[model samples]
Target: MVFFPLTHQIPIPNKDIISWIFDDPKYYQDEPMYIDAQTPSHSISLSQARILVKKLIAGFHSAGLQKGDCVCIHSFNDIHYPILVLGIIAAGGVFTGTNPSYTPFELTHHIQTADVRFVVTQPEMVGSVLEVAGTCKIGKERIWVFDVLGEEVPDGLRSWRSLLGVGERGWEGFDDEVMAGDVVAARLFSSGTTGFPKAVDISHRNLVAQHVLTQEINKKPWKQIRLFCLPMFHVAAVPIIHTSVLKAGAPAVIMLRFDLAQYLEATDRFAITEWYMVPPMVIAIVMSPLAKNYSLRSVRNVSIGAAPLSRESQRALKGLLDERAIVTHTLKTTIQRASVASYQIPKQNHKLIDDNGNEITTYDTPGERKPPSLFTTTPNQAPVYIRGPTVIKSYYKNAHATSQTLTPTSSLATGDIVYCSSTSQEWYHIDRKKELIKVRGFQVAPPEIESVLLSHPGILDAAVIGVKIRGEECPRAYVVRRPGRQWEALGEKEVRRWCEVRLARLGRF
Candidate 1:
């Protein structure tokens, strides 16, 4: 008999994201639901956000954008971002977030790949966005600015606030007719160790499944005043901040951009009860001398994800912060719709594969640590493969990529090497599949960088590899110049500048 892990019988909420965000009529719709820590007075209530979302929906519909259309947001995280995202999904449009740091060339690829119908951006980024818009043929009228800081709006573009319809004339309720199984709610770009970034199609079912799983695992009821600092475009930020945190009706501070000093000050100032950070932030906390000055005693829980945290770092972090603070390590994959697959294991959903490509299912002896390709023939060692409801349905518009990733039975090849204890049934991570590079908690594909380098006219043959610089992983490139070109002609600084202009921020070494 095949063994399967049983999950807690939690009630899974199957509906559009708006319903979950505004579920409880009495769920604390107070003055400060989302706050800008830099400017305290700039905050919005849940009621206010709801009204804005309704107006936003009416605006999009009036502007000729229909259900299933793609709307791209190119800006930093703030109170308005979540409202815009939920509003897009609420209006039945697919929401896509472009990295705020991307250049015109890099931004163009995302806009073209997603077939974005409209764009919402901040004033500072309008120049590059306009350059891409010209290339992609997106009309200037379709572009709008938001989160403006008294900056003069460009001549042809409109403000996000201006898109609002009068008195919510075309507004509907929080409810929508989208089904759980179909309709991609969010499209996230993940460079899976090779090629250009592929769009991960996260369905309504996947988001709801994640919400249910998080609710079961985190049984604590709204004690922590949380902070959202991670890039809104990444898989890690959306589920934790948008879905799970909102479901709990907890108050949160949304940072427009992450500054290390500001992060520390905010923790001390707001008496932040919970710290949700990636490994890079935790590493900074452990290493920085400034960490000693702050009063972080109010923090009761610390959660780290988007990359692995070593046992040594975990121990150091625990000692640095309150030793009593509960620090938890979470695993999130972009292909999994930002779901907690490792935490929500349903038993038969996981499998271990050896070097020889054999499935391990049983244990013959106790304490037998055989390094047979490190494959646990006895359910103890090897790479992990996972299948679950929260796993994405497919890579949007890429059937070939989808077929390669999803197995015959729909299990996602996680490419994470792991092991399971026979008696305890606890899964332990050993190493990654040697293809991905985690730079400051973001995935960097070697092939993606290699392709960029190859595109540079000065380069002929190039190979890229991940190098560990100061405890964090960074991509290092080795290049061969063209036949007639010398190393002096194409200097290292020039090549580096070439890469900086073309590659995305995370893709840079």
Candidate 2:
């Protein structure tokens, strides 16, 4: 049985991403749109951002950036990062971002795989980027420093500001629906189930659909002040920071990186109404004592992604916030499809199959999630799959990987296990199919045991992994004890007993 979104379908515009975002100038007032969390004074209003984007588009054209060319940003998040992203798309260039902490070897792989034509990086990382670019046969002329604060450029390199053209030769909008669907807007690298990274091609239509669907699902009457702590390079951050915030006409406070103290301070300082975070950060906010000092009362909504959060952690997170605050979980895939509030987006269908390759008709039964298609012979607990306007069409320059993942019906496998509820029509993520462990003919999920371990007051953090013992697979747990004199009395036997009572026989480590 295939499940569809409970929500009604909403029409998406066929215009390019830039035109869709900057649809009406009157929508934005004189208020700033993007603000720096560290230095609140450093901000960009929507009007100012549009002017900068137009100038950058002309500059990109001057620098020989043609339609379908790829431009890579290899740096941390800045206040003006959104401008650069919009500029690239407005210039008919695909925008791709690199992990700021990547090594030279990884950087070279991204540049080659994504077919990056130009690179924009920080002044501090210019030397390493140039070295990696040289190995890929990219010259210094194609490299520019992304100095947003008017900082001095490197000795042999030019600042991104220098690329701004004087006149207004901005992007001529794409009104044709066919061209919007065919044009690639961004090439994001995602290491799905397979450890190797592949460049996922996201088109203009996908961006517009994502924006429209997200807005349709989450309709807020109050003003939203979002705090972004996740890295902008991740696919999850692209739609939120780059598109959704702009579409809502909301102000977003940007953080270059996650720091517990700084994050807490920002929450209090900005009265942040919305948040986009990962499981680790949620755990930190709940387990760290520093959270007690700051005020999280201002946070009205929190969305957790990247990984699943334990029910215990979710409860603790809610306790720290206002009584009316809503904490929602988001399921994200590298293909760029997502589900908010456990409700699937309109025009998307999800299928669940059991271990014997039979479709699971009853809700509340565990099954390996797959995209709806005619083909039925899939590996047990195969990757989760999705087919929709928001999903990517294919992986860039890698036909073999694309063929292995995308089904004949054009659905992309996502490599995750999930179960649906009959009453609420909500989907719950179980675990990564590849990460499930078999113990005495029973399959066990590590997250289940980890969640139980985390509930113990004595434990601060925990991780569970499978280990082979006496030719039988067994689960092993590594737990970090909370630091204190009282917690020191807690021993291994105590932790084991806690799990013995809370977990099933196969789940106990």
Candidate 3:
């Protein structure tokens, strides 16, 4: 049962891995599939997918992207992102993604910090690349554009397709001598709420484990469709993309972005079997008037994670789906607060700490450490260990972070709280270590809301929170509007409602 024995005492074998889906080997054999976005999309069969990825690896090599090199992958939910990632890994370069919403300055910081040498983005997004071009080590000439605007390659930037097309035969050398331990895959960013985002270093071993483990969990080998709306920048779904889909060999009905009406329409159109989401996306589908309009017979599983799923939202989601639908969630796991060594539920929700500086033993008491299969630090000392193939090794370029984030032996500190079931030996997520509201289950960082509020001509500053009413949480904003000019026109209720509508992209209120 001991897969990899390291110093932390926590072991990662097939059993401890978190992917709970079932798989079928037939699907992984490489068949034609689609990554849908609007009316147009990219298609790749197993043979096609493999070839494209290897070509990218070859292309990257040709372009001087090699092992230990860093590349920032920033794109919408294109079918090509995964292929690009595989290519990056195949090329032995560090592969990380950026939040499409990141500011030019934020993008530049990560680029420099990660020492990224290449930038891959969509045509429209090239502007953002241009915004930070001067600040990054990689220049415009090195900037590569994807098929974001159909076939229209951006001027001044090279085409990603061209890179792969010319190097079609070069990538076959992947398995020849590349050791399994080589660091390859990556997902960048922090707890998605804490301090600055860091580059998560995932290796070939990490990804293969992810693929196998996810295949085992999903009960594969059946005809099913895997639906993904979230961007790959988020690691919560990283395992699913690499492991589940690869193993299942199922076709994906990908959405470049989320829209309630479009989502409902697509759900009815594709009859998606596996749907992945955060709470906000779930609530929007359930709460939208369009919810009642779909014939989503194919959707058997609703996967939610990356944030707390409100009991209210959970019920609402259930109400929207078929009565037979199953809701499976991997809770938002985090490290216990750094300030207190004993694992305590945030906001004083649990009291497991004792006066003697030790953990308390009791039934369901707060502040008590819940032995977790997964553990990661936000800024804590203890190392995190989870039984998942998708776990990353350390932060890129920051030795201080790498040393601090990893145990003396190297178990990762997930920074998200997790509770291991004593009876089940299964890990259950508890809560986040930072403050971020879930507007319809989507993450609404206070800073994002504050920035949005301040954008209004009459607003100065704002703070936001999830206010639960009868156990249902929604975003409530506190704002200081520009010094008084007729408060009635910008009534709090009106503005609040407006904010709700405006902020739906962040998450449904």
Q: Who wins the lDDT comparison?
A: 2
* Per-model TM values vs. the true structure: 0.80, 0.92, 0.69
Residue 466 of model 2, lDDT score: 93
Q: Sort by TM-score, best first: what order? A: 2, 1, 3
* lDDT for each residue of candidate 1 in 1-509, tens digit (9 for 90 to 100): 12356655545556666776676644677657777888878987787877887888888877878878899999888877877887888788888998889978789888888889899999989999988787898998899997457678888888888767544633333333346767777888876567888888887777777766655555664375887788877777777666665566667888876678898899899888788888778767876878888887777788887766655566777886665788887766788653333443542367776657788786424553432222112344555678766888788899998887887888887777666555544555544666667677555656557767866766756777888888988889999786563554887888889889877777776
**Tens digit per residue, CA lDDT, model 3, 357-463:** 24333232234354321112211212124333344456666677777555564444555433333244333344443455544444445544544565566664456
Highest-TM-score candidate: 2
Prediction RMSDs, each to the true structure: 10.2, 4.1, 10.4
In model 3, state the lDDT of residue 170: 38
Clashes in model 1: which pairs? 5-347, 362-378, 376-381
What is the lDDT for 470 in model 1? 84
* Alpha carbon lDDT of each predicted model: 0.73, 0.81, 0.58
In TM-score terms, candidate 1 sits at: 0.80
Selected candidate, larger lDDT, 1 vs 3: 1
Clashes of 3: 47
